[model samples]
Target: MRDNAFWIILQRLRTPLIVIVVTYAIAILGMVLIPGLDDKGNVYHLSFFDAFYFISYTASTIGFGETPYDFTYPQRLWVVVCIYLTAIGWFYTISAVISIISDKTLKKEMIKGRFVRQVQNFKSDFIIVLGYNRVNSEIIKRIRKANIDVVLVDHNADIINLFQLEESSMGVPVMVEDALLTSTLKDAGVNSPYCNAVISHFYKEEKNLRITILIRFLNPKVKVITRATLHDTIIAISDTDIAKVENPFEIFAKRFEIALTAPHILILENWIYKNADLADKASYLPEGRYIICGYGRLGKLIKEKLDKHGMDYIIIDENNVGTDEMIKNETFICANADDRDVLLKAGIESAVVLVAGTQNDIDNMSLFITAKKLNPDLYVISRVNTMKEISIFEKSDINWLFMIEKILINKTSLQISQPLKHSFLKRVLYKDEEWGTSLVNLLKAQLGDNPQLLHLTINEEKAFAIYHVLKANKPIGLNILLKSLANWQNYHKAIPLFLKRNGDEFLLPSNELLEIGDEILFACDAESREEIELIASNIYDLHYVQTGEEKRNWLLSKVISLL
Candidate 1:
């Protein structure tokens, strides 16, 4: 209630406050000028305040009445110059006043500034995100990993307002406004030399177009990016020469399909972020009876990786579940995943891993309890639909990974505190192209600004090394390829950390020396991208990454002998 009242008061104060400040500045200038104007041979004819009032009337161009002082030729000339400048200044000030009056956002933000103290000293190469969402915020943290500054802007100030009150960070700044407005954008330093802009849809299509139009008018030179929802809209947005524009829903579709068909990918991504070294090692050698509850798309992929690696796991499904060959060849439990007795008969007590991957939150939750009771030492992993449920799973001693909604809570919180990041990099990173390109932009800015972020294609896996581009004016690198890890996804994190060519055989990165054209897949934030790229490309000729080929050969032989 107090916050609401505070915001209301702020909204009520914005226009009047601006008017008072401008009026006072003009009044002070008028007094100083009028006193100088009435100086006639050391005998002042009019008091400075009186002359000041007369000029105020003149600037308003009120008909000459009650003149404070008689004007000589020099004094009249000064009045003429004052008339033009003061008139122009008045028009500009009034126009600005009108802009503020028509906008309610000015006050909402004034209330926020009281708490978050937005823009607590901005720096170069900052990302300014125009809309707040999960993917957008994830982009902020990914960029922040490179140690760059971030800021967020939104018309719904309550979200950011609440965020500021909770987290008292000095670097992240949140502002409330439609960034399209010049006053708000300028406040955010949109036209400043050091800033970049990322403009996302404001919960509607028209707003995206409206914001785009407004940004162009306010700053034609500023780099603006947007994510188009309609695939048809992609061409139109791109035609505008926007720094970057994508069909957001297209990426959402891809992500949906990935989860629906190949959930291991997300699982791989999670694992990569958590364990950097897991990329170089094999997912095999661990022996256990893994229990998979849901035989849905996610469950199927988990089964495939388990089978490919020669590890044994039990598949449990209700009536008519396709253990087709499974009922004959492999150990299987045919019953509900949550039925306590079904899991008990399946030897849940001895299971090493239990995956509660069903879509129904209740079912997944129920399975969690049964699995926990069966095997206290069992590693439980579940996929959640919302962040709120994360708290529920938090106590279950289970590793939690969510679907698309997963990135929201944390990303939303991060962007709320970092308004400076509403611009270029944040938008580019989330407005997707593909995984490889996404990985490249995750790299940091190097010695200069306006560096190239890749839009790439990789046909085969081979040697990766440094190369020169941009007509030799710029040098570039590819850093980390992050994977999601959790549940049975421990298999999908990464194939190998880095790969390079050694004579005729492709080898893993080694400590000896780097060679040109050697490729590496590293998982990192922005800062390490270039250095890793140079190392992979052998730009500096440092053989830091060793090829794991020799070890893989021995490991492969052992696997062959086992088979």
Candidate 2:
């Protein structure tokens, strides 16, 4: 508790403490100066102890009879002087104490002290979040939902207080300081071993980049996830240890492309995410002229993807200034999209797909509602960046609502925490059609209608492993590995998804050969995942597998040979 603010308060009290000490000293000295008078006006010697007792009683206003003798006129005058001097000293001291209690700086420091104690005592592994903006708020919600601990830091005092009020029960320790400061990062325990991830979701791109550099230097093992809106900023941290850089517009364009091409997979994805209703699966992007409202980064990305796919589309923006020549050629009308006149001029009445990619949520909603009114069958895709006006999008029955913050957080978290699983999903479930079907079949067979993505890792709780074969290791052919795995998984339901040899990936090929330096990915519901690990690690012999013989443990065999 004795931090800088504690010292400051103590410094302020120095004056009052000095006042009290000096006042008592002077009063005692005065009492001893004038000697006490005895009977018949004779002078009596006054000891220091007797003078102390007299001054103590006088200062406290509990005056009693003199112990040694009665007081004379001069001594009585000194006693009166001591009483007022001590009273003035105490009054000043009490005021100072009250002033310190009500001081804003002192209260803030006290809060910080409590936060520091709580963080130091926190037992669970936590993620350090750098900002407390709208995006970070959604991220915080999801992090808490996963029952993960969070340490929050922000520069705004009011926002911190608001968060403390809202999430007080979660016991989230918050630090109100500039996140770019290394001292602030250290105070948040970013360098601690338990701090697995640092997510820099600051509003400014520069702060995120600086935090990325700082975290990589401070603790290279701790993964960093950041968001960048500028192209140059994204490119700057691409080769660094910053594992994830979330760009909302880029992600939106990719998802948009999926909606246009493989709408079924997009529907399945939304169902898995639980972001939209699955019953509207048939109402994917309809085939007709598309209307794109806004000419900003988000709008441009969607249009570029559409142009690459040879789709017809029209763009409507408020101004033609600073517009790219190619984009200007596709601009249907250089007018306000919210105006009904511009909507009519852009053929919104017959448009099948309408995308509201504007920065303003209200404007996006207005354009969306206008398009729906013009063409009720219009496939509406709207962007919502903030939580303030989400009800408008919800009540309008829009086909797709792209919450930018939610998407960014999901993308970043996937890359940081479950990179392999995300890689598998992004590569197979979203891209390769045959592999996507194979995965869907796997999930359907295992989970039926409640298909959800799961990872199989070789932690204590789960029996799973990912390993790369080395040249020095024995080369166990794929046929032998599969036969042994199949026999072992009879009780454990384990299956290998793919094998990466060199840079080529082979998915579930029964005849594929295993070689040195091949990486494998596996998934299993039971403890059979360990069987594959043993098979890949050269624990089982092909002869023992071909016949019904017990296989020697490779670890024990190596130990025996060493002996």
Candidate 3:
């Protein structure tokens, strides 16, 4: 298609080019045919320079009077002919220029050419985002802030143009195409070694799945994160090798489950990691019957989790086509949730929890306000799909609003900023119940009641640093490192998370001996980062910090002992 478009443009240009060349030839020949005379009336033949100069001025309509001699009738007539010919040529060229400018295919080719150049010249590892919706927009913003390159691919030209206009030079290279096509993926350089990850944030589950599969097939090592909104969609990709599937409904459902079974744990996790205000804990979730408005995919998932826990709830949505059949035993109301009458019918005054799960942010906010006005003590969970709606709902009487876009952005940011820590938390700590609990408690005990979750790998003015032991040729005991940390500044704030030796990992034992290839991961405050770097630079430095004595001479000690 691209090649065809380029050829079409060249073919269209050929006519104007030929017309201009022919006009120049005829105009020059007419000038050369005319003769010229000197001021003395001595007849002299017009040189090629004079003919070319006269033709240039006459054709351009500049009309500088004839040089050295006045124009005869033949010369004047020839000048008229040259003017008409040049004007026609210029007009034809202008028409062709307009056609080329207005051609959509030509414009797309130019943009694609620029995009290809940017991709080929991109030096750093990048993420390829397969959509430009609310979630992917937020993801791109986060990725840009982290200085990682990103390429956006979508079939929506208007959306891509809006992004380009809004972001200007800061905009990512975007390709307008159906992202599910493997050709599109290849064009976006998904198979390149520097392409680290691909995020499928398409609205359609099938498109996201297809894009994911294509990305994985092309680059097996590149991380793929897909968004699936339906239960069946989740099941479809569950067995696939996709790295992560972000189902907002499922995530919300899981959150509700945690809130039900382990409320404190949820509170701690949210307070530390999610930037939730702990002072509002009392109003976060009040005790009452749960009323879910909008029985859409999200609403249904919430209901499923509630039913699995055997919780009391009622669903209110106008769309009851197959809803009644789906909800066999649960109460499902068929009414517009925005209506006040619908609120009263759904037991809004008595219900402790109100969930606005519809896709429309206005409808969700209206229902939330109505419910809040009736029962101020009710805990409302509002579903917000866009960034603009977030501010609006936040001003209302809502306890918590789930902006799934924000959630996905946060997750992707973590993955980009701290891959090792992110992997460790997700694969190791998060999977093991006991370990997760211990980690939560450990963080809380060290950092405080509501410390923001942070890894010390990156340098920050207010953040700490974590150093890894890459090469320690000599045997270094874990005790020596721990003792060295104690003598350093802010030792109380520094803690060793784990020590990995060989293929095994564990909490640092008091007397655990470190091997040549062992790695110790420890976290310390910002003030202690410099000192920690020094200790990590050399294995012998660990001994100096531990014993406050430098090893100076084995040769002198051996010589004296031998004597």
Candidate 2 lDDT, 1-563, residue by residue in tens: 34767787888899999998899889888887787777877877677788788778867778787667777888878877888899898889999999999998888787777777777786778889887877677677767766778899999989887887775327788989888998888888887878878888776788888888888788888878888878899987666755578788888888787766665566445644555433433334677788888878788788788888888889888764325665567555677889988888888888888888788998998888778788888888888977678777788788788887778767766554455545554665456334444555664565343333334332322321212322335444555444544453333344566566666766654545555445555555334444545544443433445445766778899999999
1 versus 3: better lDDT goes to: 3
What is every candidate's alpha-carbon RMSD to the true fold? 17.4, 7.0, 6.6
| Candidate 3, 1-563: lDDT as tens digits | 64555777788899899999899888887777776556877766666688788877877778788875887677778878888889999888999989998999888877877887788887889888887877777677767876888888889899887888655228488999888788888889887879888888767788777776666678878878887877677766655676688877766777776666555445444553446633324222455599988877788778788878777888888875435554575487777888888788778888989898888888888787778888888888889987876778777768778887777776666677555344443434223344445555665566544433223221222111112332323444544443445453224444566555556766533556555444455654454444555554544555466557664567888999999
Query: Candidates' lDDT values, in order?
Result: 0.52, 0.71, 0.69
- Candidate 2, which segments miss by more than 4 Å at Cα? 31-77, 122-124, 180-183, 191-193, 213-222, 237-240, 271-284, 320-332, 339-345, 412-430, 452-457, 460-563
Candidate 2: clashing residue pairs, number: 0
Q: Write the per-residue lDDT of candidate 1 for residues 349-450, one digit (tens) a residue.
A: 888877776767778888888788878887776767555566777666774344434444233323333332222223323332354232333221221212
Question: Could you arrange the candidates by TM-score from highest to lowest?
Answer: 2, 3, 1
Best by lDDT: 2
- List the lowest-lDDT window of 10 residues for candidate 3: 458-467
Clashing pairs in 3: none
The ten-residue window of minimal lDDT in model 1 covers 483-492
Model 3: lDDT of residue 239:
58
TM-score of candidate 2 to 2 decimals: 0.74
